[model samples]
Target: MHLPLDIDSVKGFLDPAEGRALHDAALAAAVRGPVLEIGAYCGKSAVYLGTACRTAGSVLYSVDHHRGSEENQPGWEYHDAELWDHAAGAMDTLPFLRATLRRAGLEETVIPIVGRSAAVARFWTTPLAMLFIDGGHTLEAALEDYRAWAPHVIRGGTLAIHDVFPDPADGGRPPFEVYTRALASDLFEEVLGVKSLRILKRL
Candidate 1:
């Protein structure tokens, strides 16, 4: 079905090729429960996945602290102002996203969880059909997110992670480090993607 919202404009924050692939994957999955998205930055990825969740008869749980990372834009002069505006803008995106989904006849789907993933997961017991992790890039943050969420993903469900590669110049550890460490436990096997995107399925 053709959606009332324009896909291209809604996904401006995502790289075209990668976003399309991820959207296709989400669409093709046999999702039996709700989908969880770790980061909803400007609602670009949310628009993509939310639409797919609607198609699959599932709801999307979008989680984000809305506190932009220091590593994301080092020396950000307007950090406070930008954060305030970003959070405000993020609040605005939620209704817009809901409208887009509703226009696409997906109003029944798409739930926004405005907080840290760890905190949000505490309220749910249903095994997630898909988990998209795009939260913090730091090892501790990523590892904590993974540890808290992975147990709730059903077997054969997909877990996708973004920004997994480390740039030595960026300093400190990357989420890829945490992902690699997690993979060592034999619970998940990394599925490659363009650049730093990684997917794994529960074994």
Candidate 2:
């Protein structure tokens, strides 16, 4: 897919290599159906998945609350003051994500759903071809997201989880735990692991 936007300049944490892997997975999975991702953030991952969806004539549903996550809030690491909304007295990344989609020429391919992941999942009935989990980092948050959304991935579909670190010092435990839970369920099988990203196939 042709990249109309400069992904490197994007305001998100998705690594370029990981983004490439995501794109590849979406390119294949989109043939089955639509792709959905939690935590669109500033749309770095959206650019990767959305473009692939566009090529497949499929859609990418991006779910996010726009508010900053736990680690992104004030005083915590990974916080960005520029994303702070003084008027709202909160962190907002919706504008930045919209800008990224527009510049990427993926406005039609990627649809943004502005709300909590669990809340949206309750109303989502579509069988997803691919589901990417990159939401909150707390154990409860991670568990809620997984329980609410993981079942919607079609059998043989792709499930991608980000920020997974086995080593305690590498990162938070929530994502790693989620990854392990998915595998332990006997419902998914690992097909690829790129950096901290784990790509599994829903059984």
Candidate 3:
């Protein structure tokens, strides 16, 4: 619960109550190993997970390409002009992430892996205690992230997915699809649901 960075000040869409849930999940899961999260936009979720990992004497590996996701790009509903890199003609949030970790004194506890989610997952061999998926909202990107990283979750570990909406009117469907896929695969079982956040335990 005590996060160094003010949750609202960080760039991202994680709900405060859901953030607390993430912290609790990360704290429990980190007992098995370090936590890994995809789509660390500006470290809002990272701050929550990272603080818990730090408290548990573990670490969090935050994965992100820094370039905006499909919804975070220009002209998208989630786009933020402040995160746009005019010179690069792209959205870059890496700086904001670094600043967040630093301000939270979590630089040592959270390792940032800057690269496409799939590219990094391809070579990742470590079994993670927790895997937080909040990457691209497109089904292709969402499925890719799930398939790439879910296998790395240790048995009984935690797997958190954001932006899932059962009702179509609530939000996008990709995240919900992945959540259902995981349940269908029988590899994970839902343990908690807060707002649009779903936390499952690996089987």
lDDT of 2 by residue, 47-131 (tens): 9999999999999999999997999999999999999999999999999999999889999999999999999999889999999
Q: Report the poorest 10 consecutive residues by lDDT, candidate 2.
A: 1-10
lDDT (Cα, tens digit) per residue for candidate 3, span 1-203: 78886688888899999999999999998988999999999989999999999999999999999998998888889999999999998999999999999999999999999999999988889999999999999999999999999999999999999999999999999999999999999999999999999999999
Clashes per prediction? 0, 0, 0
Which 10-residue span in candidate 3 carries the lowest summed lDDT?
Answer: 1-10
Badly placed stretches (over 4 Å) of model 1 are: 1-4, 7-13, 71-74, 77-83, 86-107, 166-172
TM-scores vs. true structure, each candidate: 0.78, 0.98, 0.98
TM-score of candidate 3 versus the correct structure, residues matched by position: 0.98
Query: Which residue pairs collide, candidate 1?
Result: none
lDDT of 3 at 71: 83
lDDT of 1 by residue, 81-103 (tens): 33244544522334544555555
TM-score winner, 1 or 2: 2
RMSD of 3: 0.7
- Model 2, residue 50: what's the lDDT? 96
Instruction: Score each candidate by Cα lDDT.
Output: 0.67, 0.95, 0.94
